[model samples]
Target: MDRRHCLVTGANRGLGLEFVRQLLARRHHVVATCRHPGKATALNTLAGEYPGRLHVLPLDVAEPRSHAELARELALVTDGEKLDLLVNNAGVLRGSERFGHVQPADLEASFRTNAMGPFLLVQTLASQIADGGTVANISSEVGSIALRQEFRTPSYAIGKAAQNMATSLLAQALESRRIKVVALHPGWVQTDMGGEQAALTAQESVAGLLQVIDHLDEDDSGGFLDWQGQTLPW
Candidate 1:
C-alpha cells in the first residue's frame, strides 16, 4: 500500500488510538487529535516512537472553533498536502437514562458531540481532504432506527440517527469530488465507552474496520456498514 496522509479525531485512546497505531505501523503519516494533547500520554509517546510520521494536536470535536483551529494546525503539519483518510472517531454516550428522566442537557450534549461534531468537522476540513479521499464516521448500531426493538439510550440513539443523515448528506455534497463518506459501526468493543465485557476488543474491532476501509469504493459512499464490512440498514 502507498503511504497515505491520515487524520483521526479523539485519538487519545480506544479505537481512535488503535487506528493511529495501526496506521503508523503501515507507515502512513498520521495527525491524531484529542481534547488535550498535553494529557494524552499514550499518543505523545507514540509520536516519539514514530517521529515525523505522527503528530498529536488538540481538538474538541464538539466545538466548531476547535475544528477551525485543527484545520489550521493540520495545514501546517501536512504542509498543505491533502489528507487521504479522515476518521471521525470522537463520540459521547450517556448511560442509565430512564425514558422520562432523560435530561435535556444530556440530549443536547450527545447531539453536539456525536452527531453535529463529525458533520461540521468534515465541513471545516473538506478543502484539506484529497479529492478521492475517504471519510469514516464512527457510528453505532444503537443508532439504527430500523434495528431498534426497545427503548434504550434515547439521547445516544437520536444523535446517531441524525449522524446517519449527516453522513448521507455529506456523501452527496462530496460526490462531485469523488470523496467516499460512510458511517461505520465498530461493534461492541471493549473500551472505556464499551465496557470490559463488550463483545470485541479494540484491536480486533479496529483491524476489521481498517480492512473494511481499505476495500471501500466510490459505490460504498453514504452506506452504513459494520466493522466486518456488512451493510447496515439506516
Candidate 2:
C-alpha cells in the first residue's frame, strides 16, 4: 500500500493510540492529537521511535478554538498536501444514570465530545482532506437504535446516534469529492472506556477496523459498519 498522510484525534490512548501505532507500522505519516500531549508519555515514546513519521499535537475535540488551532498547525506541516485519512476517535461516555436520573449536563457533555466535536472537526478540516480521502468516525453499537435492547449509557448512546447521522450527512455533502465517510463500531474493546471486562482487545479491534478502512469505497459511504466490515443498521 502507498504511504498516506493521516490524522487521528484522541490518540493518546486506547483505540486511538492503537490506530496510530498500526498506521505508523504501515509507514503512514501520522499526526496524532490528544487533549494533553504533555501528559501522553506513551504517545511521546512512540513519537521517539517513529521520529519524523509521527507528530503529536494537543487538541480538545470539544472546543472549536482547538480545532481551528490544529488546522493552522497542520497547514504549516503539510503545506498544500491533502490528508488521506482522518480518524475522529475522540469521545466521552458519562452518566449511565437511568431515565429519571439522567442529567442534562451529562447529555450535553457527551453530545459535545462525541457528536458535535467530530462534526465540527470534519467541517473545519474538509479542505485539508484529499479529494478521495476517508473520514472514519469511531462509533459504538450502543448507539444503534435498531439494536438497542438494553438501557445503559444513555448519554453516550444518544450522542453516538447523532454521530452516525453526522457521518451520513457528511458522506452526502462530500459526494462530489468522493470523500468516503463512515461510522465504525469498534466492538466491545477492552480499553479505559470499554472497561477490563470488554469483549475485544484494543489491538484486535483496531487491526480489524484498519482492514475495513483499507477497502472502503463510495458504496460504503454513509454506512454503519463493524471492525469486521459487517454492515450495521443505522
**Best TM-score among the predictions, by candidate number:** 1
Over the stretch 106-220, how does candidate 2's per-residue lDDT look in tens digits?
9999999999999999999999999999999999999999999989899999999999999999999999999999999999999999999999999999999999999998999
Per-residue lDDT of candidate 1, residues 1-234 (tens digit): 899999999999999999999999999999999999999999999999998899999999999999999999999999889999999999898999998799999999999999999999999999999999999999999999999999999999999999999999999999999999999999999999999999999999999999999999999999999999999998
TM-score for candidate 2: 0.98
Which stretches in model 2 have alpha-carbon errors above 4 Å? none
The C-alpha lDDT values of all candidates are: 0.96, 0.95
- Model 2: lDDT equals 0.95
Question: Poorest 10 consecutive residues of model 1 by lDDT?
Answer: 91-100
> For candidate 1, what's the RMSD?
0.6
lDDT of 1 at 198: 97
Q: How high is the lDDT of residue 7 in model 2?
A: 98
